[model samples]
Target chain A: MGSNDAVRKVHRHPERQRVDRDALYRLLDEELVGHLAMVVGGEPLIVPMAYARVADALLLHGSTGGGFALRAATEGHTVAFSVTALDGIVVARSLFDHSMNYRSAVVYGELETLGPAEEDAALIALSERLLPGRPSEVRANTRKELAATRVVRLPLADAVFKVRDAGPGEAEDDGEDHHVWAGVVPARRGWGAPVVSALTEPDAPLPPSVRRLIEVPG
Target chain B: MGSNDAVRKVHRHPERQRVDRDALYRLLDEELVGHLAMVVGGEPLIVPMAYARVADALLLHGSTGGGFALRAATEGHTVAFSVTALDGIVVARSLFDHSMNYRSAVVYGELETLGPAEEDAALIALSERLLPGRPSEVRANTRKELAATRVVRLPLADAVFKVRDAGPGEAEDDGEDHHVWAGVVPARRGWGAPVVSALTEPDAPLPPSVRRLIEVPG
Candidate 1:
């Protein structure tokens, strides 16, 4: 969480930089999908994967991440994971100053693959993050299934959290006409009605977790 | 758009791989921010950048992406960019089959700094993509501002696209309780009303582009 290093520098918009652990945790908790970035074959590669923030570490589903993230972990290479929530759009007086309202977090660390016990817990944690309060409603993972799933852990020690949530910052002395309106167009995300698939029983009741999911917005 | 390259493989979910140009084009055109991944100081780094698809190339705003992207362009290093639209979450009968419905794209290529004319056009294209018709509403960037902006271009080649759009795909004979209701929870993103800043004139009218953005959902 120190700021003296080159990796943590927010050079362009230093004012937007945040070093608190809460910022990073909130960002990871809010987004279920993160772009897991790694060096593959001497070139950069990225795969969008389902992830979870368990306490202070990140658990990545290697199968969903294309299995290369697991390989990177075994190879002892440092990987970077990034998540973002585009809050809104800032319409400025000029195109140069036009920007986006967003909260972005990038975590960099060497990954460690979890063993059987931790893997089961990590996969359940990932599922809970993706669909909260749903683990108790379904069956547990079989032994083969647990072995098939690859979960890697990355400590939350190194990360950068940046947020921009404000109105336009147009200079007062700028020569643009104030009559040209400028402000923000906020973004909102919500969950729609639960769609029952054909395989489900016609009279089967929806789980309590799903009812909560429909009622809440995340 | 060929799929014979190493970077274009979608191993785990081979059935979800898409080779059509429409799929790739639509994914790029829809999202404004992408995770730009590159190797910095022997470690993986990912930055969420505002990007636009112009013709057959991706134009990244270097200033918004941070100065390192421009430096990476000049250094002749390759980078990867990824974008995702989480359409919904599939609540399957079991935890193993539970997954997210998403459209993800990853583009791998080296970057090139744009010339003056191309930079101006690319900048306009970036803004136009982010806020559809708003480019025409705002004033042009000043000469000094143009000089300060670093716009890099990457051809839309050697990319991979994967999509999962169907409902829960639980097998008929998988031997789970039929009474466990399962389905999909759709995700929706919409723009709220614009908040006029204090600096704007009281009677200033909202631009048509802003109105169009609110009326149409992307």
Candidate 2:
């Protein structure tokens, strides 16, 4: 629940910054994808990657032959992974104070490429994270398939979470008219109908994991 | 309508790589936020920023005082700005092929801080992007408010766009079961009911911008 190093402290919005470890873990677990960024060729390069939180580390899915994440892992560069969720819109009387309610976290760490037993464990963890309770419903990955995928893990030792969940901010005697509309409009993400593939049998039932996800309201 | 240089080209999935300028412009215009990142102190630093596209450049909103983006602008670092939209989940027959249907773009370039007249225009563009028709319904920003904000612009010259909008991918003779249910689960984002501030009159009519945004279904 304490601060990381001085270099990664949240300075811009001190009020919104959170130092709790649970906040960091919760943010990582709730989001399915994140932006992984690193400097390459003297310019910043960032790409969205699918990730899963397993304990205190992040398992990033990377293709052995093509993924830039793999290159970052090979180079042992300190990478940044960012996850953000937009909560709502904060409407204010003045445009200057208009803001978005959101929760964001940025983690700074070096990615280590996993091998052998750890790689299989990371892949299984990633699968469960993406589709809970479905690992048993699926077949095991062939050796060739496993060999083509590279799993990289980043320890969650240095991260910062910032959240803005309240209503619009108004300054004291800001001189704006009182007869204006100001409030918040909540935003959310939801899953639509599960589309069965045309090739699959029409009567095949939906997987339990998929059923539970859509049945529960977001 | 052409590709960028080799260093910034999309080599991972050439089929998903889009060279059309309209596609790149549409993706940037549709998204309200992006992750701006650079290598600072030999570590990657990224922050989520509200941005808008005007012509061929991105205008990012940042605090002039404590924002890391402001520091990046002052340092003249070649920053990376990434925007991604997760359209849906492609539920394959096997977890090996499971993937997310998404459109992602990573732009490599430098951020230039806007000047007097351009700053005003950039601010307006950003406001319109975040909330359409909002500027007309709100009061103009004060001189001090304007001075405290910094708007950084990044050209869309060196960029790459990749999109996966299809259903599950199945390999020929991959030795997988035929009876498993597999398809795409569509995902969507929506806005909830607007909560009017308690301070405002209960019967205060909603602004035209707010009314239009929520009334229309996503």
Candidate 3:
């Protein structure tokens, strides 16, 4: 085992602050999906979902027929939500001390069902959040489509934000002479080459949302 | 919400299947690092850890002095174990319907205390698993380091495997005509450029085990 495998409070770096409320919201808004875990019938169920931000709440949408979705809506059980992005691997002199630099958010809250108008707005917000201005470019949801969907909004108050950034901790014996290449190998995420749909008409121009996002910096 | 957002039983493709128990063991073995969650003092505690496999069981090592670790060892609480690899971003046509392609295992089992010899074997197995062949190259653990570590093993029978593979699913009517770019964005995991430890002598070569896995074939 690596020497630093301990999960004690001391190992939990305090310097990795939880920024603030707005920063937290920004992080949530920027991400397209999250993992939702809840205790249902005394057993834990974890499911992946795409989510949107509604004021100080997170909005999760699913089919009206999904077992978890129906149960969560009808019973109003509290749920745990988590979003994680692995940024880099931290290799230390001792194998046991190796670590991962990551950003994660964990939240617990009861979900509130949204009415028709609220649901539509939440869906649009989610689309826009995921692809910046993409919602305006794509065809809007039809009334029939809206009738078959379900949306749940959960307040963000009961969440815990945990993050680890910066380089790996330096060992007490770390020095110039130690000769350990002690520095971060940065990881970056961005779009790769886009593939046009096979059936897309030759006349249909590339959507502005995709073009704009590609131009913007992450 | 996109039309494919309804209840669907995701299929497991052949290439994604584990052909042998050895493959499952390798998956468990390769990911020596994990996050273990269980109830401690009536509240949930998530502990990051290094684990080893012995026969059909998984051994988790912790500091004998740690709170949750000690409490868990003495109380023998039931714990949930999960190991996940985020393989790719699966972009389906629908915003609410999009999903991630991932591999994850969830296990629920009671923890057990490991005997001295079992503990030693577990550590060696874990080290060799993390960096295959490292156990032979590096010096064996000292008696002091062994005495300071606490190892607990959790068995396999009570586990369920869930996975999502293949490309994203589209709604019945949201056919190939939608013109949206839809497919998976692949993610790769392997050793990055190795950083030689500053403490190592100038001409020291990377051990064979480390070199072997540096660029593992897909």
Candidate 4:
């Protein structure tokens, strides 16, 4: 589909549609998970997936077992991948006007399975994106593990990005009282103190990557 | 579908499947937004929507515009509504096993549009759920506003709930070194301080509902 084709256009609220390519990349880069929807056996199946944006494509990897990603790639079925960040709760004087502040992007396309040669690089990119500054610190993936994983890529060409970042919209003549408190309660995701695993050595220091992740703001 | 039917069962990881009805309700109740997926002209359209779970059904309301929810309801199409809560980020020594702690529920059913008589109560339930303890504080919805809103309900039956709530699972025989620090970094959603709207009266005291929301830990 074309970039601005009617099929991918935002029809519900035309005002919230965003066409900037950078905005779409920023949203994809920031979110850790996405919901993947595809038609399976004539029934729509939506599954939460861990994904990373690599260049112009989204990289998704799953085990070789009954994996949705593997099935979709093998069948060349069209899928819709959506990433949504709920920013806040918009409290309005009227219930009808109350809403949520959010940024969402939905991409539609068929996923292509990566070949064995490219799978290793894609896996490294996914790891680096999910756990920044750690790919070098950890041991490389073994061939057995790599063979059991399925990696797929979906391009970001046909996508729609919509954002509602402002506070509640209230009209002057809505008839609701003006004295009521109305605004936005921002919702944010933050990382708590990391808990060391049970099998870790007693004196193992916190990795620099984990430390940096804690220092960074979401 | 039966509670544990093959279609509703969590095939990939049967261990994470939660069969309790109360667990499904709790997950839906805690989450404020859900991804609604419906097939439109043979293409899957997934939209993040503000939703509230009442008793045995989810209440969703949208404007009379080209809203997907309204279209799905009007056409009596089958839709899948999914709610996911990311509890924590799992930091594992093995890139292959890295995962996120989360609770997700997907309900598959045809949406039923509520009649005018039931729309009012559904809207109130939605408002109360989103901004708890606020419906009584604000004025009731005006007739004009209610007339322009479309509400639909989807039952909680035929739903699947999956949860992953533990630290990273590691095998003793695994080749990865045990010296690395690996565990979970809890991810949580919290409300920031409320910012009063521009049209609100100056020095309008924070509503009790807003105050309560701030006090409650997410």
Candidate 5:
């Protein structure tokens, strides 16, 4: 999938572009914040981070501070990460086709910097792709906290994804007024009850990796 | 709050940066999706948009198709626009302190482009900030759908606003194992159950602006 000239199709919905590499690893394994962009000083920054997807790359950790993912892994430059997710809102009865049922992706390369034994297996594959059965329930990284953390991998071979998840295209001689309540409102993203930390142990029990992330589901 | 040299403080927690103006209008009125970025040909593209926040600016609309927000509103360049939200995931106990309780902002300037009489009041303040009371319950834009849409805007004076809503910053002889389950997993973002439109009228009802967005409160 990394080949129709690898990424760059979808000049604004080129049929919701998706050169499927399993829909770019299912929108980089169901998004958890991404945005990274680059070119600092000559402006364009972006930021947001927190990423994961460890196998074909895309790791990104920080705190060796002076960050922009540690200066795009010490100036190898050329960045651009993205991710997105927002899957559902598209109410369309026209506010110029009110849309938003996203999935996004983006990628673009150059970021490597891992070493120190591949940043402790890219921080335990970014804590098992952000806490899925919690990297064997915590407690491991210590070489002085993996030499004060920095990670940075980025390589889903120049990605692109774009989905939209249907519903609301409205156009049967589209003259508006179909009694409007037009479909889709979805936009979910759950996991609420788990505020614990007063420094834990006030009956220390909710940890089957945080009760399987609030019984998973959203 | 556009001056401590206005917007360039958080280089990675320069103390959760935020130069206030009502915390950049409550993270651009509780975000809906932003990203945007620029520099097209020499790389860095980004995209995702769907923005809103009317008054001090930040609007963005598209469809005149040669995309990247109509080429960053026709090459008046300097783009950026971010917006994040994420609000919770912090499951720390170290995976190098697993973070993410975001609120982001970003903004860096130059987008203007709005005239079709201020693109119909920035598309009714982006359809009343994305369907909140569904732009007085639908049906309005028609001057050939406001001459095929494009909008733009951007200003909130070079914004910044980086928040990280606490819970999980542990340190007390920091050696791990204080009985696991470290806090925060919140990440809410609601609004589901609305499906309605197959062309509406299957006994058409659910409206009070989609029943006040499923009783709001996320």
Candidate 6:
């Protein structure tokens, strides 16, 4: 992937770290959630949350009444957010060589509140990201509902993206002699049979976005 | 799935949350990796890393060279660690009721370094926790390796164990028509085929512990 963005770096094994704009965009678009990490009193805390993408910024929405979210908004602190999917485990002969093959992104930035118009757009982006076509199916957010929720963006800057995909390497000692079972347990994602809400008609078809989900080896 | 030991009221669904001592111990044992959340400098951060459990305490293995581990060793600092598994998504009718069915333990306390004997015990326990019987197959840790790796343990106290599970609650307007998909995607765990070092014999049978893995539906 080409590194067209300022926040991304090739890092060591530039091949392993994708810095291209398209790759980064796809990574963000495919994942539905991220773990947001920040330093509180110098200790590390992580929160798993959902998110949406809009151009160069990623939108996060939460209740203004939430303790963590409120503290994050009021303090305006810099935070690190990561989205990772472990595809498989790479087990080698030596313990130290045992590692996981995964796609991960670490983004560092300060939270910025969305402006009046941007907030609405961000929510739409988030709704579409999570439910896809359902954003149009559900009733639009009322003025009161919008006022109660908080939306903010964390720009794509100071980020590191790393990935490793391949089978395990041969042991250093007698290469062919080490006979151990070796293969990958592929991770996958897919929607289960949809359940019609108790209030819905018995045979309402699944929405396009939910139905159109593509399975990727996790 | 009893409320006998649950820490959070909302997370104490009997059918969804589990409290078997053996099960909890096994959950912590079979898993070699987890997310560590800490409060440093009044901010929260989550670090995803490998971990090992030893007896009644959880040992966080790290290097003196790493910044986070290094700062943790300094006196007069407190750290809280949590391990969470998202078992399934509970898609309720109302947005306010939407939640995840998960198993998590939040540990609060100051971390302390293990003594020489405790370090040895910790490493063995960690090995067993990660690979079960493999501690016997692999060579024991050398004094140098033990000395090189730093092991810090947080006592089991000050921990809040929580979980949630069950189907969505019926909407108050149940007779009214609606169109929403709701169901569950059960999560399962077991040992994948183990990778033998390229140098191992091609037909070595896996140790009993690894081969006799317990598959649990979370």
Share of true Cα-Cα contacts across chains kept by each model: 0.76, 0.66, 0.06, 0.66, 0.69, 0.24
Write one digit per residue (lDDT tens) for candidate 5, span A1-218. Answer: 22223225665668877788877787788777788776655556676777688668788775212364466435766777888887778787767777778878888787878778888988887777777777777777889878767777888887777778877888632667677668888877777888887777777677787787778766
Model 6 C-alpha lDDT per residue in residues A23-81, reported as the tens digit of each score? 77777887765666665445444545567778887887641112354354446676766
Q: Residue pairs in steric clash, candidate 2?
A: none
Native-to-model Cα distance after best TM-score fit, residue A163 in candidate 2, in Å: 1.0
| Candidate 4 TM-score, true structure as reference | 0.93
Evaluated on the second chain alone, the candidates' TM-scores are 0.92, 0.91, 0.81, 0.92, 0.40, 0.73
Question: Considering only N, C-alpha and C atoms within 3 Å, which residue pairs clash in candidate 1?
Answer: none
Candidate 2 lDDT tens digits, B1-218: 22224446665767888788898888888777788877666566778888888988888886211375567445766777889887787777667788888888887777887788777777777788888998888877778878877888889887778888887787542866768888888877778889887667777788988888888765
Model 1: lDDT of residue B157: 76
Report lDDT (CA) for all predictions: 0.81, 0.76, 0.56, 0.78, 0.72, 0.54
- Between candidates 4 and 6, the one scoring higher on lDDT is 4
Deviating ranges (above 4 Å) for candidate 2: A1-7, A63-66, B1-7, B63-66
What order do you get sorting by TM-score, best first? 1, 4, 2, 6, 3, 5
Whose DockQ is greatest here? 1
Q: What range of 10 consecutive residues in model 1 chain B has the weakest lDDT sum?
A: B1-10
True lDDT of residue B14, candidate 3: 30
DockQ for candidate 2, C-alpha atoms: 0.57
The two-chain DockQ for each candidate, comma-separated, is 0.63, 0.57, 0.16, 0.57, 0.26, 0.24
Error of 3 at A104 (Å): 3.5
Candidate 3 vs candidate 6: the TM-score winner is 6
Residue range B162-203, candidate 5, lDDT tens digits: 778888888742867777768888877787787876777776
Give the per-residue lDDT digits (tens) of candidate 4, residues B1-218: 42213444565878887888988888888888888876666666677787889889988665212274457545766778889888887778887777788888889888888889898998899899888988898888888877878788888877878889887888732867888888888886778889889888997899999899888875
**Weakest 10 consecutive residues, lDDT, candidate 3 chain B?**
B1-10
Q: List, residue by residue over B50-150, the lDDT tens digit for candidate 3.
A: 56676788877641123354455346555666665555555445654444566655556677777888777776776565556656654456576577566
